[model samples]
Target: MEDEHEAIDRLSTRIDEKLSSFSTVSLPMCFKVPNLLRQTNEKAYEPQIISIGPYHHGKDHLKGMEAHKIFYLNRLLQRRGETGVRKYVMALKVKEEKIRECYAEPLDHNIDGDALVEMMLLDGCFIIEIIREYQTWNLGELQERNGNFRNFNVESVVCDLLLVENQLPFFVLSELFHMTPEPNQENDEHEATDHLSIWIDHEKLSSFSTVSSSGCSIFRVPNLLRQTNEKAYEPHIISIGPYHHGKDHLKGMEVHKMHYLKRLLQRRGETSAHRYLMALKDEEKKIRECYAEPLNPKFDGDALAKMMILDGCFIIELIRENQTETQKIDVDFRNFNRFSLKRDLLLVENQLPFFVLTKLFQMTGGPNQENVQGFIPLALLFFSRVMPGYGNGLVIRDQNIKNLLGLVLDSWVPSLKARDNYRKISKEYGGWNFKYSATELHEAGIKFKKIDHEKIVIKPEIDEAGNEVIKMGNEKSFFDIKFENDVLWIPTIKMYAYTDSILRNFIVHEQCHNNDTRYVTDYVTFMDCLINTSKDVELLRHSGIIVNNGLGDDEVVATVFNKLCDSIVFSKKSFYSEIFIKVKGYREKKWNLWMANLKHNYFNTPWALISVLAAVSLLILAAVQTIYSHLSYYKR
Candidate 1:
């Protein structure tokens, strides 16, 4: 009838007293309950004795006592309120204060849950309650109270703390803890982390997965912090070795220590083993949440990235296994978040060994080479996530790469073949680029013509307002625009057309200059160069926003256009028309001067130079002809 804590503490003290009789069982306090060894046959507590190994205990009786003690302690903590009843929780709060002092700076969000759990595991119920209350108190409606959001970290800390205790079965707790908040801010943006729920060893993952694992996957890390420090390990590998009997054995599997870790610290000016331990303690207390978890099923891409940074090999292995397993299950890629994986691909693509990358590229489905190539945007963002300034290991910008993708998709694939795919893709409601929409005819003295043997042609029609209209057929259709050197690449009607109009207009206006001399296709090199230039502009814009919000005129124009585009895409036809009108007005105002200059400059210098050279040659020939004529007259 008494609480579990009261009963366990009494039993524990009796065991501790008895354990003292054996010298081999030194450090009895290091374990939870000292009584596990009191009896040879521990059938009563046998269910709890998943593992029993001696660190210093050599005597058989002492070893048995150590196991018994740990068994009781593990049981005590497993039930939430047991430790609190024993008054150990009060001491835990004091210990937590000591733990806090270990870190130089206020702990970042990463360490909150882990720290709380570690403190709880060491201290007991009162301390756990205090931490929980502290978190809860911090969560009041007031701005000040809301400022330090501690409650969110509590579950994770508790979960992780329990995990590092390494008392629970691996897959059991692994499945028990893998959950996250919504990954992306909005549904439209394909965010990677939107609440990860991981499945491992065929077990269901739980919420607050952060507390349930010892290390996080690299993908779960924020883009900015993944590279700031290097002391952290990527907990990527999980040994599924000879003793694959149960979760306990698997959970306690040793993480292969980095051989260079000591050397790294020493080189970084850590003088002694004590100093190294101090730094590690600080990292564990402040950066790690009492404990951390390895990448698991519920880990969002950001967590996955973090795990990768800690241990790229482990995350990649899991990814390979998961992808294979998921494929076997025929799971849709759309169902689970894919963005979390983007960072991993980027991290391992360059940092890991070549064999790893080769193996990753070898994964079935999607042309390995093309998938690797088209996934540059995903890669660039990922490296930026792991290490922001870590360039894509190449000079290419995202836009340039996109253009390059366009060219590759174009030059390598014939238009006829692409058109076929494009036509087929147009019919679907959501697959690929197909979206269901009603088409209307435009009228401006033009007609919509369906060439029997050719692609659909736009012939204009005069609407009631005498405006131009183009009518699409009764069937829903989408144009299959390959990433080729065509209108598809020009930011027109597909992809991000309206938002990128300024950019598109710039490309076209620049192309007009080249077009005066040669056909548009003939001057592909010129288009390529402009595409590169525009990409630089976009990068500069993004960089400006990142460093300092610079509300320049161009930025204003771009933002307004983006807003208008968003409205058009999300709003009804009436709203789209109004937005389109504003867009046209803005486009006209923005490009009037640039367009005029483009026209004036188009045929001016190059054409003038050619004309002058021709004139000079003609003059020289005329003079020679006159001289010959005069010489002939003199001879006559």
Candidate 2:
């Protein structure tokens, strides 16, 4: 017994050693945001003027920034003295192995240990110098730098610094800042621990308590549409998260964001911004974990909290500006020209987590002072003009929503009960199959009508097996299409240039986070199946089912739907399955086919019906004359 116990203990010790070895190689905090996503919008992920970290290091286009980096490094060394520079380099060298582990893949062999140390020294010093410049400017000790850096375009640099791939660990920067402390700046050290606070928190607010979380809210777009139009998924005007933070095209909107942030702070009175920042600081870990990719360590609690506070406040203020209609004298007039901006905010890439927005709103007297409905309603109102057929009689529960795009899609989807009804009816009918197009159905004696002012509500039912069965009634909107007496009732959809982008992003979000309930994908797939050619588009247009909003020729619309559905794999269990079964059943009936043939061949139009009636009358007259003549001959 003693010998057996000794052997078991040895085996357990070996297992523990192996587990410890595996844990030593920690998971990476940053990855090359998948090539599939990058292929769609290379500019969205790529740094334009400056490359912060080694990912795009030494590229020909980014070589120009090397001079600026050296300039910043020289400035940093001059201020810190030679001793401080050596101290920063030594601190980073000690963390070299650990820092390398933070990358998703191994760095190039050419970038040897010394090369990496040199790169970090240069990059980290440059970053510290820029932040110090910004800090001194805020303190009225130094003037704003001239050249391109003075323009609003320089905000792009700030954006580039925050990207997941373009980051240095927070501890490295914190060490450098501490080694070269500014004179009489002891009290500000806590706020200056991260680079983000220098740019975002100009007020120098003190740190506060933290918060807990339930789960993550952010997600990556599914890879399904990566090969399709990249612009459909890319944000045009603004960026929200680290995914597309800083691009040259989107820099114009930064001024607007700052403007909105200023207005939001003023509206909240004193200490509101501080309170908002503290609340966000508490929930920092939850926010970082919500992202699909692990965030760079530089996005420490304070850095993330500042981002959430600024971004959340900007969005809330935009919603408020649109809803209140009060003409504030200082408001940027370009913001009111919202057709493009509103669409930009709803893009999957350009979104803050919904919960963060709600937290900011509630804390800032959004519910009490605003007298508005809620964040969802305010968002709906702001986006209503761009997204037609939405925000009307729609109720979105907070728990059900994931993000802005998710909220819009959830509102458009049918309720759980309605989907269950579809499944049950589809099962009862033995399976739903694809049928004819709108034009073919019309030829087969089917009619088309538009549904207006009807609300679709779902009711619950229980079966004998104790399972919940969805009993569909007229009160609920089942599928986007409904067939009654060969008449297909479809709601009108207005198509615009951004319509495809909205649908594509919504589908991506649905596929990524809500795969089980793919309501949007099912609807798009159904529409794609129904419209095979341009003639199908024309038929729907004539039937008042499709309203075009400068989307070009009808053929283009047909091609859009066809291409949108390309490579898309939809579940067989769809909300439209039952409607499809009914249409197929009606088309298969021999009596219905014969009646349709009669209608088409003899009574298709008023002129054709009149000709047939005249001929029948003439035949009756000829028959009477022949009978009279036969009677006269018989008498003779």
Candidate 3:
């Protein structure tokens, strides 16, 4: 053991070091919105026009306003009669460590200590200048003094300043706010303390010119179609595009919209966000035309650009984060639900134009990258669960994907050989003429075999003899159905709570648009033909062709497919025309239909079946007796 005094001195020094470290260690005032809550609405927590703190400081779109911060800092210095930035820099440096420690995560990843102090000085002063303007109500004089019209939106800036992610520590702000030579007005100090309350005192924010538009690529679900199932068409977690932009229940995801914009800028550094803003501005006419509903008058070009960029970036990030998981987003399991976000993305009404999403996605590509991955594959991966093909590892050959739903429709397409029967539209594709339910087909000595989608099979090339491609054998989409050799090969269709909604949305999308081939509709119509009653549902369910996931009972599945096509008045179907013809051929022979009817109807009653059995037994005994009598005569 050491001497007492020596130990005491060592202990004292350790205590001092610990005190210094702990004293400077600031509690986290700024936190990343939890991924679960962030998923709700992405835009509400993000800073759009200006980013005040390090979390959003380096974003390209928000970066354009940096010069304005310098300008405002100069204005602050001039108004306070200070000729130099020395004192302001010196003041912020003292509290830099504590200021940085206020964030939930380490700030070193975003900025160095010196740079952090400078940001604090600039942001603090910028906020002060905006408040000062409000205090004096001399925006015109200030504009005149600057000799340049303010290029940024004050209202949006103020709104950004108030964002949780954009906030600086209050002590840092308060200390910087009180640094100025105090003017005679007591209100100036009070305003500085309450600087976050700054908002443009105007009724309307005119950031861009207004324009009118019509004829939309994104349309609302018609009541006729939506009436089948309203929740399927509506977004539960988040909204996309202009139609469901600001619904209160779905508002929680806006922060994530803003967060990913920040994340996007961090990952791929481009020039000023003004580049994207101006690009979107030029697209105003097209955007207006794409939405079936008129652009809200309140949504000018600038406002629209801000909303779109946030939403677009948010969407891209959502897909990216969910890219690695199986059937769900990679999440902090405590917060994010196990179910996918595809429910919202797949809706017909809840869509951003594929072009808009592609535009932002392509433009945001990292400059150093040699080859950028196409958006189609990433989108396909995110929606693999709902897509008929699983959409994973398969080569996507189509480039004409119009939107998310359209991508899924493309994925549902069977191989060329599988589609040989459905390539051309048959006059009877949409007609309800020759049909046999699953039960009826089973009774006709036509074997009902479920195609296991989990195995792998090679679909031979239509043109090339030796060329073939591997496809889902056990795990396949519902669209691949075949009738051959007295057997019907139907792929499994996993029914979930959302399956009805997913298929309904797909059907309605086809019903609304004039698709040359209604792939989803034809598939649903084929299923409707196969499942006429609860008995048919039972047959399919028993064959492992219909896997129920949380959806209750066979009767519900029966009612679902039974009523699928009832709401559609005008629909053209072609994908399953060949399969329909083959099934018709099997049932067309009089013997098949008569025997199927006999097995289905006659054997179904107890007494009648017993009577038939008794009659058949008596006939067999009489035939045996005649054979014995003939044998006896031959022996004599």
Candidate 4:
């Protein structure tokens, strides 16, 4: 007991010592130079004396000015009438997370938050002093203290301050700037901000620009996306659109595509494909523009019209065959690997516009049958089997359906609320986060629970006298994640062979598609960040968050998620940001960390728990023996 108490005392003293050293340089608040600055002043923007923000920070040539920044900071503190560094640091420290988020890249975690906040304080004050003294070179204190301020080329420093790399966040500087009093200097500060805002707002405005549908929503998969799992994007049994229209490896499915198209004409009681051909020619330009990339130059208007008509008719007929057994085509879609075709249809590169398929369906269908249901619901009916949630009431009206991948995504998101929560980009640049794998979080006292995949159903019913009734079943979305009371409730994900491919393509679509809604990407990225290795995979598997359905070992599942995010850009502010902040708060409590260590190191293992019990029994026996000896001595 004496040894343990002494060790704790030493630790407490060490922590106090570290806290006293908080006023030092640390993390950078930086982003790339905005293109607006590059275009107008490309040749003229380099930091002459020192870097202000994170962009040009840590350059070898700029190290000499570090002493000068401190030199200016010291003078500013005296002028502001501040006694110590604690108050300024405390002020900025309260906003440390928000301050770090104002930059584009994620900051390194090596520096403690207190130290980073201290750096901001130093930089903010340094800017005010250097700029103030640059114009009025007769700083009475500086003239007396040192010759360094006199040696500085004030004009060069002023020009350097205007560069985008030299730009500090306005709010950060403003917080420190207003702490001190200066006669008529508010006008000068406002003027300087006005100039910076002209460049700052230019970039901000572009990021928040209104999202609109560019008729060309379908994109050719970039090589960066294909690196994860190449076969997933490539159609094994068939090709659908212009991007994969004529690859030799996919030629076997060509005969099957034509057979289905011929069967469709037979069902329509038409001997000629002339009407479909003419219809396709009329809409060739529209169809051509629907693909984001240009078609093969060899495919002029006639070739494109033929390909569009054939591909469009093939998909309509294929879905028709899948949707109904009664309206059967003579060719056997059942004998082939139907799963391969379904997987191929979900690929981002292999897609036809919903309109093209709709047009072909309307032309080929009997008016009575076609009028019964719109193309959107019919399409959803087929894809719902693969994705599993669109048949529910949450799907919006489908006039806006872009393609197959979009339809599949609509099915994945369970509710309008989940969609809105993900799409809500914060106006404040404040969603920077830390990645904590499943094992790491488990050791930090977070409990993981698998959300029941049952649909929570409620109904108002008259039962004998009259009462309301509620019901539920096993059917919920994988994206409905909840975190509360240090318990994370996530829906179980079933991993199949096609799971990796489909997820990668979905991520790519979200990256390139319109409306800035990357709900699918965000969810996958969150899961990837949690599963760092097979150990994390095993922890999550035991908790029922990940279910491997014959997808090799746990390591394979872990590798799938870890590599899924390669070369993919993630939004700085995302759906899980608040959850991350809450989890950090929970883990930061010292009691939680100590308790977690105790529970994991002792109670979780049988031999360790037994050893702990033995040690505790010895301590209790020693105390009782000492008490008896004292009582006997007193009685005597």
Candidate 5:
């Protein structure tokens, strides 16, 4: 009997311990910027203007925004008339515990339940009011409260509100929002009561929900490269997603976003905004899950919905205006260069969910009110300006392209089946072991030729052994190379100032988001092998395979490629394994080696060719004279 009692006690204790462990393991939506990534570029991860969530909540510099929060909260209450603040506080009280659970870290003991509720109330009201003000442009009341509010930079505030560390749970804001008065339905009890029950249902629904692993396509830049080149991942002129929300340096671009936003409203009509907002609200939960991190506490369904609508509209409009020559001719393109905007849009951190863009484009009736082809085509057109052949021969519909950078990478990389074949080839042919430079290959009689990108096609074939094979067909692409007649025919690749940034981000994307194919990394590795010095760069340049726009000197280009190669962790399998084997086989041939030496010695230039022919003629005459002298001696 004692043994049975002890066993029961032990089982109970184990159950209690497991429950305790589960309670402590909260789902973290937002994470404290990793120490390694932060150490490299502290500015990229740190909030500059205002703090949104608990992480940077009580910082001294960010306290200035506290006054604005209170002001917005007062405005919200005033719009509600009597007992508004009390009702908001009461609603948030019920959500205080739920809100605390959303963050990965535990709340400080000093910030009791009351303090937490009040923070939620104030921050929630501020975000809702700010978004409302942006939509309505009603600065009259704000000016009356404080003249400086009229001059406040909306861009900086909008950016700050979206940071990962600066977010509030959507439920808390949704709860508080129910207490606020609704326009045109002030007397409708059902409208106000409807939201209260909806919030509860959302709470219950969210608790039981599990985000699928494949759902989140967005990813932070890999820590390895982020530590070394944060600027490469960061947006210089504009903030897109929650990651690099509000920096002072990026304020100039905020005005442009605003201009684009206003233009969008003017062009699409104000009703279009409402339609897009509704569409985003419907997909808010899925959109939030798409982000790798949980949104900041400030982003309730309403606030996030508003942001998606505005940002999506701005992007769609920007693409539309840029494409129409009449619009382009009227606007001063010099101030807002398409190339600069393209760079900003392609940054890994600066991206919206492609779905949001697609939804907005569809809601706006698309170009000509037809199917939603405008978004992808316009996006491709924009990127192709910066990266030649980016959209050429690409079926955008065939890809699960997540963002601008993803689209750019999809255009350049081979298909999944092709990548698998390449991996198999690499494994079968002694792995990715080739490391000869361009100059070395040239010396080994491997002549270099430029392939025309227009005529190339990538075709899949079945080998004699019944194995499926894929080859870089006649399809000419940026990195396509073919070996024929002891020559390596490589397509021309243009290297500009922004090439490093584009390549690095694409590599980082592959490192973080993609697991199967490392096409960009493999391409970089192959380039590194081919380019060891300025002579290699010169050789490629002479072959018309490299179009150096603003990459400075050949030494600089060599250093760039070398450093890029050093940073990435290359896979054992490579996309160019078959080509490497062919080059190696050609180099091993004695006849080819002899022909290379003979060419280098005697046929390097026109003058050298003429001198070699003269020498051969003299040798023939001397041999004939010697033969005649021998014959005369024999006769005597």
Candidate 6:
């Protein structure tokens, strides 16, 4: 029994050592920030000097926080000389006033003060004040072991001071010093006696950048200020949208607006235009930079971009890749003078399909410059979506829109309309009428028409003994697949038809009886790459054919799928090994179908047809022989 207890102790010690090692490697940088700040303070502490926060929580918590070691805080404060210490003192004073204001009570000032101090401690502001007060006072008496308090601000202090500060006080008081120190602990402390302090001097905090006075500092939204050096309401960055506009639209534009606009575009030759993207921290500086001529026609490239935004969805846009060279550069402004708004501005309504189309356009390239003016809104929407700090997800929820999108993607790629001798052809395809509109279908409650199979017939019932006493013969074959009540019931296949592509693939590729479905994903992806990319699908002809061994129960799911393939085809050994290691589960299944088609297709090999013909001929010969033998027997 003694040995068992000893072994348990040994095991616990090993576990604790392992846990400490793991924490060092796995903890993130954020976990070290608070500690770093504490260390900065520790380096500034003098051996006899002690600092405390005006706030209760700060004093109470930091009184023994692992980061509160005197040597570290003092070291940090030393670098800034006395200036850093003074600044910390001022900040702490400000925090103290804030704490007092929060805990103000009219009656029984002592109770109010006590409650307020404890409240501040609970709020974390108290700790900040304590650290500030401790640093400013440099009270050496507070550093003594079993240090006695000179004064009590509230009820009896529920804390004890220790000469050493290496870990959070809670842990030390509760675990290490809850009772008299063990013999080993006493020996360890005797050999180690060091005092130090450190401080990290940061630049003065600005009012706008400091944590909000309202305790809700973490969640407050940032306020963007306009720059006085530049013009108000005019951003330093200008993004021209994909929508086209005539050059005449640019004629009456405000000259002042143009100046700011040009500056924003950086066409004036300075790289400062990009500064608009900076956060609110440098809003004023960014504006001043824009004053240096932002945009110039000569150097500034045409701002052609398509942008879209939803009330809730993030903004989306399409910026043209580059200017394409055409033989004739036509500059026609005769009928292009209208100031039309971007399609996205009209609101969602029944506009899902059109919205999707605009998104695709934005994904492609920006509009041509014949319509650069009168496109600021579109440009703004586009930039809002593609801008570095913005996040948006485009989703088409309307059924009509989804169907129309499917058709459009299936039919033709989006492109610009070109003038021809014949009347101009609308670049838009699919969703030509309200029938294909997303709103129209949704209002009508249209749904996909599912094809139904013939009803299944019931079979004769059998008893548990397997004895058919009653003569029941008529029955229907239970081999047809059925989709009933939103459930895919495949009686023949004995598998559910999962609508989700991934789930279905998992079921097929991983869960199927033969693992026959597993290879489909790979095959599909391969086929798509081959066929869509102009590569000949026939190239797969050399690949081994995947034949489903009719034995469903004996089929391999995936582990042996490749082995079976090699068994039948006998391909290169290295190719087999490479495939097994590279592909785990596949995303494409069409490639498998493509491979099967390639192997079976008569176009690839005339020999297949020849083989079929030979088999038919042999069957015919056997029939003739059988008929001849029967006739001879009858004559005998």
lDDT of 5 by residue, 281-358 (tens): 899877887775567888888888877766676677777766775555645345665666677778776778887887
Q: How much RMSD separates candidate 1 from the native structure?
A: 30.6
Candidate 6 residue lDDT tens string, 42-141: 5332112222222222332233231222223333333323322333333233444333332222223443433333222222322333444465553332
Clashing pairs in 2: 210-282, 211-282, 456-477, 457-475, 457-476
Could you give me the TM-score of model 5 versus the true structure?
A: 0.58
What would the C-alpha RMSD of candidate 2 be, to one decimal place?
21.2
Model 5 deviation from native, Cα RMSD in Å: 19.7
Q: Provide the overall lDDT of each model, using Cα atoms, as 2-decimal numbers.
A: 0.28, 0.64, 0.66, 0.66, 0.66, 0.25
Off by over 4 Å in 4: 1-214, 325-331, 368-373, 388-393, 419-432, 454-476, 599-610, 624-636
On the 0 to 100 scale, the lDDT of residue 424 in model 2 is 67
lDDT of 6: 0.25
> Which model is ahead, 1 or 5, in terms of TM-score?
5
Candidate 2, 1-636: lDDT as tens digits:
999999999999999999998798877776788878878977678765577767878775556456456556555545543312444555676889987887887788788766677677777777887787787563112212332131113445666787767877676677777766654332222223333323212221111001112344565443335556778878777777666766788777777767777776676566346777788888876677567555656667777787777777778877766667753564575454457666777777677877788777776654453322356656765665576443222344667676777776665666455665566675433222475776566767778776653433323345577644323233333235678887888777778878888777776665445255467677777778678788889888888778889887889889888777643435446667677777878876898778767767888689999999999999999999999999999999
Which candidate number would show the highest TM-score if scored against the true structure?
A: 4
Residue 452 local lDDT, model 4: 67
The regions of model 2 sitting more than 4 angstroms off are 1-216, 296-298, 327-337, 366-373, 390-395, 415-420, 423-435, 454-480, 594-636
Per-prediction backbone clash count: 83, 5, 23, 2, 14, 81
What lDDT score goes with residue 136 in model 2?
Answer: 54
Model 1 CA lDDT for position 73: 35
Query: TM-score, each model?
Result: 0.18, 0.57, 0.58, 0.60, 0.58, 0.19
Alpha carbon deviation, residue 276, candidate 4 (Å): 0.7
Per-residue lDDT over 91-184 for candidate 3, one digit per residue giving the tens place of the 0 to 100 score: 7767776776788987756587667876887788778767777787544334323322223224455667777788888887788777774553
Off by over 4 Å in 3: 1-215, 268-275, 325-340, 367-373, 388-399, 419-421, 424-430, 453-477, 569-573, 605-611, 618-636
